[model samples]
Target chain A: MKLEDQRTTVYKVDPDHPETESLPTLRTEELLLNMGPQHPSTHGVLKVILELEGERLVKSTPVMGFLHRGVEKLAEGGTYHQFIPHTDRLDYVCAMYNNFAYCRAIEKLMDITVPDRAEYLRTIVAEVQRIIGHLFWLGTQALDIGAMTVFFYTFRDREILLDWFDELCGARLTTSWYRIGGVEKDFTPSLFEKLKKFLEYFPPKIDEYVIFLEKNRIWLARTRGVAVISAEDALSFGLSGPTLRGSGVDYDLRKYEPYSAYPRCEFSVPVGKNGDTYDRYWIRVEEIRESLKIVTQCLEQIEPGPILADVPSVTLPPKDRVFTNLESMIQQFKLFSQGFEAPAGEIYCGTEAHKGELGFYIVSTGGGNPYRLKIRAPSFIHMGAFDFMSRGYMIADAITLFGSYDIVMGECDR
Target chain B: MHAIAEKIQEKFPAGFLNAQEWRGDLAITVKREALHDVCTYLRRDPDMDCDYFVHVSSVDWPDDEERFEVVYEVYSIRKRHRIRIKTRVPEHDCIVDSMTDLWYGADFMEREVFDMMGIRFRNHPDLRRILMPDDYTEGYPLRKDFPVQGKGWRDSFDFLQDPN
Candidate 1:
């Protein structure tokens, strides 16, 4: 029998038949269960309405917006510069990339060219952010699948990266280090040495984590061939980043539309044959290595230069310059007060964020503020296919399916 | 991209309203009624195959005669080309054809647009509030006329307590 036919076997029951009515009257009704909104295994505030027939999932519907902060509506009211901090709140685990993605959107909107050094710096930090994000996902995902040891190991290593972020920016989680024109500041010599050390030290840690999970029978049994999605299905569902790549899709915005210093760097996109939970897990682990490689190349290519772009009108003047020169003060005041005017147009800028294509569709009506901003969050899109992916799978495998998606509620509900 | 636009124009001259380009992205405005057909052509047509549905959002233009502009962004993974389709839907009649039949991913996107912008879908399988709660009776938040802080929903703790 074909797999499709086997999965879709419908048992016809004659309600009026004597034998059917007399056979103990065993009527099996679908059990409606709410999986989330508060449950730890459901990640953050993700509520799923699941209709189950025994262990098999009959149907699933993901309920989101428990963490909705209306960031898009907030963006319309605030200036482009003021909205940078708010971007950090979305996907707070990888705040740097959110900042980078948003800044890149507005940068494209205003048509401001970022300096080479800034691009290199942004690329390096963004990759570092990706590693941090993957590390968080690895820890939480392992914890969800009854592997507490892996969580501890991943979190221990994740701390070093978080510390590096703290050193780079004043805040740790919501690191609004990226600016519209460029980055806030250049990395210090000590910070650069620390980053170089981190870049050297991280790949082996990824391998160590992978080694622990790769051949483990429990891990294999739980993940292998579970929540499988084909390449076509993944693309049709708008899955991107490692999630789509895990499903044998070779569509990475970083590779397709090379932005920032991505064009200069040489890195391979890892794809999986089987689009399963294990494949997605392995893809993220491989991507950690690939991100480290990109960071290494960025470190080698990065040189000392102006971190901020030369667009004085768009970027805020230096505090020292503002204090000393009258022109600089005026520029600073004007930049903060009226904000730089963007051309009356609409543009969609998608950067390969940690989870997926963190796309920002900005529509500017020739003003300092965007008329409308829509965040094409990958987590939100991935949640759309949750029901399709979780169907026909065991209730236990539902956790694995959810973990594989790597959804951050903040981004999904934004 | 203009070639693709020209092809679309040739295929459905009545549906194709206008075409423009910005930042190298091809955008074509179409009739609201022909959205389903245009989307089918974009997805199934080998010459103009746009299989990937990126996003679907609505922009509220209260002053405009149409009132709401529904935007759809789709990408052709095979061709490596992207195109944006815009259709105007009036406030009184907020219904537009859903592309869920073409791309299942448009399910939640259409729901979100409906939830926030108050635009309804014609053939959407399950069009409900995906983000906002089911009991949410407030006006669509994404409307331009909607207040930022909202109309007294925040101050009231009535939503916190179960009505039942």
Candidate 2:
């Protein structure tokens, strides 16, 4: 039987009613689907309520704060020096950037200038962290889009960098190597050699990872033209880093407001024409290459000098000095116990992290502990535009949207 | 004074209270009633094109007459300049105009301020708790009076109780 005839026979027309319709209409309603407070693709504990009309997403409400430990509130309770470790937990995946950003903010507040060598060191480590962050994002985002081979390839290279971080600092993931004035220690000979070798080995690996997804039909279909936002909307929504640059708005804090060793190094910021998932992915990959170039330049230009800024009131004494000299021991003790007094003012300093602009706004009332500390976490701000971008996209693209923003729940909820 | 601050002061003399520049950051304090107008001017004016919304933060000053200070930091992508627009509201009337219409990104940021500081936004479309749970009945967590250890609600939860 024909489909129309079957439908007509299924719903028998009422002969008694003169105005009976020819076919019965199917009742349709929007489906409310919850995509995860615990789902693996969310990167962290993040819940998004997706309103679906069939397969298309009508609206999405991101229910954040599953990982809220009140890092800002905790900052109010600790001294300025004590808060360094606390920042390590903000963006757990890329803790070095958080430390760099927080320490940069404090340095700005105190008007401390880092030495040239320290600046180069900070930039090198920060770029390495950027590479790791992009690798983590690439691996997980490809896995979310159903390409599994790229994940293994990307993570394989990521392991080397993590091991480098382990040798650089004692810890691998939560390396608090950055301090208020400068880096904790200088690069050793072995560390320098390993970094130089990795710099040569990394470019081909990037090409290998790209080969997996560059022409894969499924990857192209899944990422291309997905979650497209205009340049105007992106700026108005305060999107930054690759997410903002993907929309063709060249608003990089490193280039616009140069800081650290970025001003000294020569590198290009990659921008995309079409603001979509594919463009964002391309921007991240290009950024990794640019970061490698930056690291190489820093290595070539670096000169032997003091790593830490010798500011007695603000910076800590060296470990050797602290153990041998009583005055140095007293200085370290006083710094850790009482904390250096900060000026009674407020300042906001922004750093260009791998994900986006990580800014710290500190309010000091001439005390050791900050009166109020506000973190302008990019992941949290990007979530604001979730419903607008996710609308009209497929329900499955929800995971793609999350991956594109590189939304870490720890920073989002902080 | 910053050129933008000077322009804001010239445009809204009655609304403008003071301007402070410290550490290359320009902060302007405006009357609470004129907060929206000042931000609108900042957004629409060609010379003061502060289109990028950075963040919305609130500070509690328990001792002051106006107990809550609302801060809205904005940057102009084209101009590459930043401005911090601040306004004060008393504890009894802890409300400010919403900037969601001007900058769509302010939706979540203002909601966060409302959630943490208990300062309401007048025309915010969705002014519910963002980082905190919706059903949370305790006071705002960012308030100074709110204990750092929290309200001990976690200890009082039914999950912690032993099933007899």
Candidate 3:
């Protein structure tokens, strides 16, 4: 019999008296399916092994390390100043936050205080980077769930942010704009004007995306009540960022730790009632609105001042000073050749990256380079819950479950 | 932070090694054998309540008598304070009790430690090489003795030559 005929005949003769019929019983075995170390929906090179009985997943395991570059080992060999570029590649989508987190970790270890104006500049750029990171996630996630229009709309705004990044720094994507003391250079007057305009224009676009996705019949069936994780299980699994907040856990690192200019701002962290895919989606959208409010506040508060702190050995001197003064020239050469010495200690600094709590544990042995640097990447820990979350769900709905975590594999495998 | 450290010392006197504070974070080193009991007490005790498991990683200190120091970072969500629990494992006995029963999140973090730092975990349900490939027979990449550029794998790769 043909494959279609076999399936049809088994169902047709089995309703009233299955034992009385002369047909053999249909046997189904667990099927193993490999879903991409290279698929488009995975966001990066993440491979998942699925064992399914018919269409329902029996067991699932996420196999990572395809994009592993041994970032921790590289940190052991390089100077503290040289490691800033390495952080840019960890969470490449929100590159500015990676730079900020790593630099802040070093600053905390050495007890270096950032200047007042530099703190506000770091705050403004970091929030703008948060929107860019969430925008990329929203576009790709909506496309994965079969909504094509949001991808176009989100990317259209993301281009404007990227262009602004290029104008501020030299590059767009992997911008090493943040330095150890502060930002590389202050935002120009025109760049500040552009950021103010973007803050004004973005709130209505968020409403438009929400309007398009809120009542769509396909979006409702796909996301509502799908891949539900309770508040307690979400906490025990070590989930952070918006994924944990979606479960009604009010543990925003910004609100809890109050780093940088976050303590001065008067924005609210949105919490979800139901821990589902729709809640996570709603959390990111609401967060963008809150981030815009912070940017508007920063624009009014920012004042003109020196961008970099006046730390002698750590912060790089100005270009004019390096050209004219001999002492400044020697200081620049010594910093690059041998990084500044740090007191022997270990500290783990966790920042509210766009994805989650991006933690960096640096162990220095009073040397120029770190003795050991372990990155507590949020995506790596988030992937551990894949087997627990995806069990007993249809294999087709696995995409929705994976999409809800908002994981980027660069940080996962690093 | 000192109160919690004193509480653990009062409960298990022999298990506590010493407590050190750096940059306002408390780090308490404990005996390796008593780690499971200490962790369980920290999780269940109402005053301690270190419910959130931040991460579990190991640092290679080849010069020390106990060469590998396994570090566990935990935070109390309700109390809003953090602490570090450090336990040393000798080079020969690199196995530590797994916390998979306590927190579901430690599953892969322990496996990654086993894969990279060559540490093993007892009572772990699924212990295998996670980040490295299945057939990989090379030494642990994160160990102090392992060369950063790698040994023969890069130079022996045949496809690196020009095809034309």
Candidate 4:
């Protein structure tokens, strides 16, 4: 066929008729867009199916379980003591807090009172971990919003604490420094001096990070008034930590429940009013300052005493005692091999992690191994409200929404 | 008995089975049919005010007549108290009313409980496998019978074979 013959007349535009009865109607439908199981802005392997009417998101269905390691099932097979290391992988970004939370849960189950000094130590280390978590979140969230310099500035400050963690424990990321009843060891003089130095060096650095993003037009435009959820919805959806506080709900477990040394510390829980991404970011930044205050208070108030609880049946003996004393060695061997008998009952302990409330629900049947273990991961819970929050926002703002929750897929999927 | 337990028992005397306060946590067990009404009462009652949905978890007991126990733990922000509502479900009829309508967060938590323990939730809007894949055929992982080592899906993979 000739070129002219191939080009058939489709719809003719009539000059006289302004309504254009001759024009063909266009078929428009909502476009389905898959955000990621591998996308970088997702922070980890999390996929969300977004239905878009043009650029604005109509609805989003988050497809999780890409990183399901069945951590709860593994907990049933192992003793209570064996599960501390596994908690490290839950929110892999902040492992010390996971260790602390898990140890607190086990202590609650065993009904063991942590020593005064050990409680102070746990509080200090946990506050330091909170600072690390906030720093990580600030850096990553800023990077997700296209602010790269803040990432470098925040991470540089984060490295000093990570190194301090390395000196406190052996490893940095998976530092299982918390025992069931108490901490593994006491802080040395050098470690104390390093923390004192960090406390001094950290406050101005937090100010430096705020200056980088607090005034940036791009950061403000991307985060302000984006993915807002009301205080009622946040509570109804069971959001905690900065995510819930950003919605103007002062429902922090640290403040309300008062576990560990949080009751002893004088730090305030920063709550936001707007319930937007910017408010969430502001709350996190303010929390970093409060965490610093907590660590400083802990340092001053901390006294020298036993790091581990003196329960021979439940707690582990000191490393020095295990080597010298035969009775201590036998106690260590028994506790490691067969965990202390947890009473036949169930307990749910919720700890306020940086992300949100990381709760563990354990049912024990008078044995070392738990009958059933349930982890109420906040990331997974926050994802439940994603469709509600991200309804009218642009497609690009999806990353901002994920960052606002400070979600980690390891915990979410598990 | 705690005041909350007494209140629940006063409201639904026939539905209430047992109420125990252990480890400073109040747990109340209700008849399976009355689970929804009890939760609705807890959510709507001004005194209870249990607005925050904490978690939905289930425990399995193979030896018991009621093989499964569904657990729902909710907290009240205003009152600053928590309650654990539990109901037993036999293996043959393993179903309970969903609280997703009451608490939006219960959508994922109930889905998780359904996925891991194979306990179905009636009136759940979008009930599907959450942690596991959509096509997962093996039994519930949290059940006492499900082995710690998975159900041979890993062994069936062809990549592990020796290439001679």
After TM-score superposition, what is the CA distance of residue A39 in candidate 1 from its true location, in Å? 0.7
Chain A TM-score, candidate 3?
Answer: 0.93
What's the CA error at residue B153 for candidate 2, in Å? Answer: 2.4
Error in Å for residue B150 of model 4: 0.7
- Badly placed stretches (over 4 Å) of model 1 are A1-24, B156-164
For model 2, residues B88-129, the per-residue Cα lDDT tens digits are 999999999999999999999999999999999999887878
Tell me the deviation in Å of residue B50 in model 4. 0.8
lDDT of the candidates, in the order given: 0.87, 0.92, 0.87, 0.90
lDDT of 1 by residue, B64-107 (tens): 99999999999988899988999998999989999998888999
Off by over 4 Å in 2: A1-24, B157-164
lDDT of 4 by residue, A1-414 (tens): 122322222333455886766667866667778889999989899888887778998878888999999999999988899999999999998999999888888888889999999999999898889999999999999999999999999899889989988998888899999998899989999999999998888788888888889789999999999999999999899999999999999988998999888898887888999999999999999999998899899899988899999988889999999999999999889888898889999999999999999999989999889888888899999999998999889999999999999999999997
Residue B9 miss distance in model 3 (angstroms):
1.1
Candidates ranked, most accurate by DockQ first: 2, 3, 4, 1
Question: Residue by residue across A71-122, what tens digits does model 3's lDDT show?
Answer: 9999999999899999989988889999999989988898888887898999
Question: Candidate 2: lDDT over CA atoms?
Answer: 0.92
lDDT leader: 2
**What local lDDT does model 1 show for residue A105?**
88
Higher-ranked by DockQ: 1 or 3: 3
Full candidate order by lDDT, most accurate first: 2, 4, 1, 3
